[model samples]
Target chain A: MNTIALLPHQQSPAVELDYTTFQTLLRARMKQAPDREFLVFPETDRRFTYREFYEISVSAVDWVGRQVEQGGTVCIIFRNTPEFLAIFFGAVALGITVVPVNPDLAVPEIRFIVENSGSHSVFFDPDMKGKLVPLEAELPEVRFSPLADVSELPKVDVPAIEAQLPHVEMTTPAAIIYTSGTTGFPKGVILSHMNFLVDGKGIAEWFQLNADTRSLCILPLFHNNGLVVSLASALHAGGAIIMIDPKASLRSFWALVERYNATFTSVMPSILAAILALGSDGRPGYLKGIISGGQYLPPSLGKRFESRFGVPIFEGFGSTEATSYSCFQAYPAERRAPGSVGRVMPISEMKVVDENDMEVPDGTEGEICIRGANVAIGYHNLPELQALRFRNGWYHCGDYGSRSREGDYYFSSRKDDLIVKGGEKIYPAEIENVLCMYPEVTECATIGIDDAILGQEICAFARLKEQTLVTESELLAFCAQSLARFKQPKRIVIINHLGDMPELPKGPTKKILYRVLRDYYERRLANSQDPEGLKWVLGSQGGG
Target chain B: MTIPELYAALSPLAEQVLRIPQFDKTLTMMSTPSWDSLRHVQLLSAIEQKFGIEISGDDAFKLTSAEKLVQYLHRQTEGKPQA
Candidate 1:
């Protein structure tokens, strides 16, 4: 498939920052104009110019080189702060595979990622010690250190800027980003340096970002959207960034925007919905415009927000595999086509393919597959799974969508059993495994129910052990300990396995037909088809 | 709206959005464990729908306590009981 960039033909990176490593790029930028501000922490009233940021990152690299051994992964688990920047940049500079974990998640949730990704050194913000200290047992091998001490690191003489053999190649693995896998365990996608650099430049080009652009980092630093869309794009565009914690309230979101005069930002659909719910006062001040990604932006909502706020809401589409965005709408020059994810960016070729991997016609709905320098090599430690997904040199997105003859792409639905609630991907297997862990539960399956506020709500159907009684509150409490708040089931339906019980349908392989369960819930969601036998064990949302 | 009227209005909001059994003076943002930042948005959306008024982003952050939200909503609908 021929990749088409929908950006204006005149758009290009103001400063072409192509280099072997981010260390080299940072050094080059610092030398170009050291006084230019790179990042601003508005909450703390702290700012780091190109020169200051480079000095801090280099000293961080020196500290890690001395204190931590040179063997295993160095994970950075912090919120949106300057510390996150130093730790991630320093680790990436030293060619250490960095795993950015969301600190806001529960400790057990964080521990799951820490356990899966083997790491020797873990860097975090000292302020988060209360939440992290409890996880010492889960990750005993990890050497913990706070990033505050990095303030004293500027004077330390760092090693020379020499690329170590076999460690710092364009295709060498740079980071392991974990996204919700269809199966229970989360799969880490191994991204290369080429992926970051190319995706950064591509985003800068598509967004028409320049040195004057002031971007906002509202999304959690752990997600790929935060890294590629906000940080990396600003890094290469020579623009500044406004870093704020993800917990910032809707009011604070606007305060930061007005305070920083932010121009570019990428937000999830839910955030936009909340902002628009504010009616007239929702629009942020002096924004060039904002783009929406990470989930579907309903055309009506996008159009409503745009017309009300006087700001264009361009919709883009990408996954952890594509680094950031494979499809994006060009702003200013043309208005967005409501549901379209725009055209494929340069360095990425996207095609809508059928079951046999053949390209389908323009208007035909098919699996959206992308091939690009930005696509991750494969899933880490999952060769068979990788082979299944990365077929024909195209990374199958597992997303069902179609393309236009004009080169725009339109999303339809997901092919995999994934539920996106408020932009957080929740696989049914994860919730089901947790439910089946209870002694009273015999069989359980989680499915997505359409919601008006959240994009989808999780509904769990369980067949309890004969004569075993379990309260909805008790089961919800059990789920709270294992899953994040967003992943918890919104409703639990207790299915009796007696004479009138409707056993879940099965396929040819005897695997439970998740489609049948999903359809039943989908019908129940329509306000008229709810079955009388489906006992509501959870919240009243279970019933119509 | 009196405190009783305000409490009556917030009963369904908390139950629907936070999935709490009931609302009281105890269910402030800092008190209720589930009334975190994310849930706050849903609560505000529900309040807006129930009151037939818009909650500004600034007001959403300030209306942390049900008491404060009631005061604000009470003032907005002070003149007309129909509101």
Candidate 2:
């Protein structure tokens, strides 16, 4: 196994990790607390103790062993469920990398991931048979199996599979997580067992998580946030996880937390906004803190949620390439700086660099770079992208940010998201943060539209609260108070005005898709005679 | 309204909003992938619009299955004039 070479300054008082591979970790947990509740699937009302899950993993080994060899890759398509966890744990323990595809993606998108990752087989939910069965003929080399329950797997004696288990190493690839790329085909991020474990341990230590910590997982397991932050971190801390289907969990979010006595949960900012809009009122119960990331968390939304629910939100910063999160707001919520993503964790080193890759002084806007044991090996099958992103011995996170003199980091925007209007660079968050502060505005996103004179003109989309009416002119007038002339949006599209889009276009995790909004503009409003008054134009297009 | 009557009235709306071929008592968010959170909200909104009744946020999430939704609707429209 290749070890990460850490600089002297990067070293810290490390948390001791006794197990090298996932198999040993599960074995250790089973021996330590055989009957303790480890995994809970609230939707199906199923619970698995440590011993029960270990036995299920053994069965998974037997079933998967028949179809796939060690070092082979298999694609799994399932919502958050016990079967997904069982297969994931079993496959990783056997040194077979697992590729988890979002079951909601269209067939062509799913086929692209399966073929690109070179998965030997695809295990999916029986509910998805209608969507996936057709792909079987399209890709004859891949095996497709639909599983309704983990019990459907052929059972094997626990000791028999245990004796024949392969010698898995820490550097063995565990999962190839596909990022929802904004352009072109999505790239698969290859992460090793060490990558997951180290980042998981870092999160656990940073939050002071322990066996008493019960994480409510509302994020999809297909994403890195759900896998590394929720599942892997809880596993590293020997804590219990309450898993719920991300699609069906929003309405029941508070109820589930109270019912399960969940102390910690990770979610995107949109979840908080939805909860607030639903007007769900109740005590936070035993919930200690909420981890918000995977997208920018508007300061107004964060402050409102905290004031209303009395639960602190610990927003962090990271990408799929770096496991989950490399930094988070300080613990206890009160110690966190208001608008910052917080200090870099002890397990990783973070710095802001210029175009030449030289480290920049504090308070300078530049690309943020991370180097740590938790960083992924590289992107799968894209060597050019791998070399470009992973150059200089540091993974160049294509995000623009600045480090404060006090050591807190502030994320500005994506490197591509920088809007150069008349040569004045503007980050979308600056305008979005101001727009979201409006009383009726539930959520909003800002993007740059093509302009003849300025190269790129500012455009914004805002989703108003249900049953609320606010004119485009009124919102523009509101922006004029906070923003200068150039920074203000040239056109603001109220998503509610567009009859087809009840909410802003969002990914599966509910992050607003700015790219889709740009395309919408290019198609509908670019050459319109009246760009600001979109009501007639959208009406003509059958959208209003 | 009776349980069967409630189910009969809700069948078309559930089918329309969830975009499923059919709706049955066995259907649930866990069992039917089409009954996702977004569709769950739309289904509740359609029911509200059809019956002219407001479903509180507190009660909205608990109605995950067709059985639960039918029972909830029955309780909500027990003596009211159905739209």
Candidate 3:
């Protein structure tokens, strides 16, 4: 039997293992279960076994070896495609750092990410022909390669760059993932291989993942949730992953699930709402569980989905700065606590603290801070932000929340999103959560609108369900019934759709675009008489 | 008929209504502020009604600037084939 060293506190009685690197993890899985299916995507009619995927990935590694020098940064500007996975891992294999850029970013945003990352080479999808034209002239040193042309890249028998590669200690920087700066310029969160390894191993151990485990990839791989929790975790756990096309909306997701018999999936609350809107009959039969992140999962929707599908919608939370999942509700409806995001993992530790970094008592709201092996080293080229967020050996997550006496963490609100209305502290998420319970409300965002009398008033931008219509007053009444008067939105703006729904950008660790929505509505409110009038104006103007 | 010409022809109120910044003459309307499929539909329909010229769907998708819109108008008025 092959000797497997044991990691500290590893409870795997069957196989004592210490997988230090992603490459080692992949190779071990291939040796142990070469014939097992490694990846499945029925929507694209693509499935690869462990042997097949390993071979291709190795070949891709060899291919990239000839193309890039050591320590070169390769920018990836493709949607969530299988090719993206191959390219990402392929670059990693060659000791090259990969910067996955969101393909849906607007021109200016795209330019900022690419330029700020200081990447000299990029691999792009052919579909983005016109989008990059504006910035192409400015990037004189940047070389662009189309994915469509990669097949035609001449195969040279170049020696493996492995020998030339430096010893990549787990603590060495692997990649710099950019946070979606909805409020300011995007920051590069410098994550090392150790950060990723700890997160993947920690989450896998916590969730009991193994070679037989399969996770459906619906979230954006550019973001940490899809990359770390879904892809990296599968790699470390010796499991299979199915890539979902970013363009394939929730409308056709269940069919794809049935085709692949997907065991697990992950998505944000908006995506969950979209799936729920598809009806219970629309749910696929093969799903074992889904880890919902990127946004808070409303208990009502979570209950509706779990009761209807018989598959638990497990709520998980983490930030890009901390890799993927820091905390999650495991299995069994009995162990699950309502409205709680669950306890921290074994490899991770958490403390709810005030602005002074002192721990708050249980049941009191405070900034939820995290300390673990999974936390990133620091942000690249951002000393100020690095010092601010990473201090005293802990990641000061800007999220405000409280912990129950039982150690269950409950999310309250973002410290930045707190509204002081007439000296009353109100969280928009609390109001938005109440509004989401209403059947007519497909999605809602709360923002503090300018009010000369009250200094600031709560205004809600709501997208109603299809063919389901309710007056603004009725929606407000629903909020009034469930929440305190101060928490109730002073005004509601009803619309057909909040966004494209799928291509919505998520924060580093899959948080919703609340800051983006707030800015958008604030701009809208600046020019309009009222929230209702802004809705009418926006609808009439045909600008989403 | 360039984007600049269109911006020049329109009053400042119309420019503000469009919500686009700077009228670059060489740019296409599709790249402009109010140029999404829905907004394009409304803008084109209004333009057609105002100018009394029908824009084919194919040509409409291809029209990136006000200059292209003017060319399409000239072609329609000059009895040229719509294609």
Candidate 4:
């Protein structure tokens, strides 16, 4: 087994791993380029220069700092807006652990993360009042603040702000991003300030970002792609941030790119498909390329979008546990492998390993594991699980991919049957837990099936306690209450003859055979097979 | 295209992309949930393909509704010298 350590391009500057905290970096950039625009909203014709952004952020830090105890957790749930980033940077700048929650999540979902992270205070979008209002009574210990909009964030004249920058260590916990595992519930992934900076520097250097480069924040800030890859990278490079309102037009995206003169943007495969559907009509401005990740993008879609939009596409592979990305198509233009997730970034160590966590030979498909400055410490409060994941000094990514002899990596299978639908990760255990609650359900499993538009849509299989006791619609309705819209099964297959299907398909320990089920779904949903045939007695379309 | 012609051109897309049962000048992207940001983009894509005109990202927001988009399209074509 060999580790692939990518080298920085000769033209690319060395990644700065010396920055102790985000505040130090932000203040450094402010000193370097105070007059230059730091954050720009092209659609609204509003721009915040480095000095202005810093001053505004200074005020936010002051506001949030007073509310939380030293090193206590602060959660921010907002749409893609000025207030969101400001509060996020404010929290990190103060050395508080910021929890970035999906603003669209229902109160119960929000409650789950809030309780798990033990948030001392929460700052959410005003529009989320309906959902977050319940938390006022539900979690009485947690303080809440509703930022009206970006427009309302005051830019105060906070002159000696450096004196207020909190002292923080590189390994100090900075963020707790919630991710689901086999536990059927979201686990809090604790990331350090160094994790963000290390990944940011790697991404910035790889993407060739500098003072002139501007990146658009189209991905949600809750995801590392938006916060670290796009935002922190730009900030670290002394580049600019073009914050697009997430709900903005897809056709308008290219226009925004040109309008803002954005040099780089981060995207997902589904967003690429949408951009490709528009074809090559708009005159794109300064967009050099897109940093794509979350799900696999076939080279065909990459070719179509790049040729049509006249912008190159580079895919990356990483997760919350990796802080951002361990492997990406880095610089020099010439070393990019279009079909793969590119080579390991210079800052991290990557390799493929066997089921026992032993190193597998190069070119053989195995679980991809990474160890680096960017790798997260472990899940918060889950020591047993942490020991399992952090064995042999490597964070074992459950994803199955192989490193080529040439040093490039390719993703062969999703980790732990992860369903990536429209760039959102849905774990089978989360949905299966809900399905199991129904009295009629005896056993259940969930799998992902590829779709033309969305990268993959969810397909579920369940064995009922009584043969004809439950209807598909009834189970789907029950699921809708517990699951997010994206996680809801697009199709459900009933295993009427469960005994005939390989005697419930079990592994050595009598664990349900998930691999076998996923393979059967792949065969059943193959392009050559009649997908409808599986729906006859075998399947039914779930609610939405 | 005339106002009526513009309405006719957008009718099908309004149904397919936006699901506006009946589109009129009063119907804006803000008025319908279907035309929310994502669908507004799909609508813009359809309109650009339908008319073969390019709208800049800054200009896309100005085409807020059927009336504004049609008026803008008419202005562009009218600006063209008689070919």
The candidate scoring highest on lDDT is 2
lDDT of 4 by residue, A1-544 (tens): 0122211111122344657688778878988889998997655567899888877788788777778766889888875667887887777887889999976554567788988898879898765665567688888988889887654665555765657666887778889998766777888888888788888988888777899988888887887778898888998899998877555646567677776788888888988876665453655578788888988898888887776767778888998898988888756556687678989888788889998878888899999988777888678999999888877778887889998888999899866678888788888888899898988888888878877556887877888865466777788878877675557787767776444463346788988787888787676545643453212211111111
Give the Å error, residue A326, model 2.
0.4
lDDT of 3 by residue, B15-60 (tens): 4444455444444432342443223444554566555566543344
Per-residue lDDT value at A479 in model 2: 78
Q: For each predicted model, how many residue pairs clash, with residues at least 3 apart or on different chains? A: 0, 0, 5, 1
lDDT by residue (A67-159, candidate 1, tens digit) is: 655435767877677777777777776667888876656667677777777777778766557667878756677788877645756565544
Model 4 error, position A287 (Å): 1.9
State chain A's TM-score for model 2: 0.78
lDDT of 3 by residue, A1-544 (tens): 0233222212122232366555656767888999998876554356788777666666667666566776787788775665676677677766677888866555655677778888887777666666677667778788776664334444533244334444545555667787634234567877766678778887788777877778888666777777888888887888888876533434346655675667777776655554554342555576767887655566887887777667787787778777877888867446878788988887778889987899999999999988766777777778887788877767887888998999888887776775544323355676777788888776777777654323366888787777876888899878765554445687887756444342223588966576776676666556665443322222332211
Query: What are the interface RMSDs of all the models?
Result: 7.2, 10.3, 11.7, 9.1
Q: Considering the true interface contacts (CA pairs under 8 Å between chains A and B), give the fraction that model 3 also has.
A: 0.00
Worst 10 residues of 2 chain A by lDDT: A535-544
Going through the candidates in order, their DockQ values are 0.13, 0.26, 0.03, 0.19
lDDT of 2 by residue, A1-544 (tens): 2254443222333434667777888888888989988999876679998899989988998888888999999999888988898889889988999999877565666888999999979998886777677799899989997778987878788998999999987878999998644343568999988888888989999999988889999888988889988988898888899998876676678888888889999987767765665565757898989998766677887888899999999989888888989999999788999999998998888999999999999999999988787888888989888888888778898999999999999999787776655333466776787788899999988888865324467888899998998998889888765554556787888888886777778899988788898888788777863642322111222110
The worst-scoring run of ten residues by lDDT in candidate 1 chain A lies at A1-10
What are the TM-scores, per candidate, against the unseen true structure? 0.82, 0.77, 0.66, 0.82
Clashing pairs in 3: A294-A510, B1-B67, B28-B64, B29-B64, B29-B65
Please give the distance, in angstroms, between residue A465's alpha carbon in candidate 3 and its true position after superposition: 38
Off by over 4 Å in 3: A1-17, A149-166, A418-544, B1-83
TM-score of chain A of each: 0.89, 0.78, 0.74, 0.89
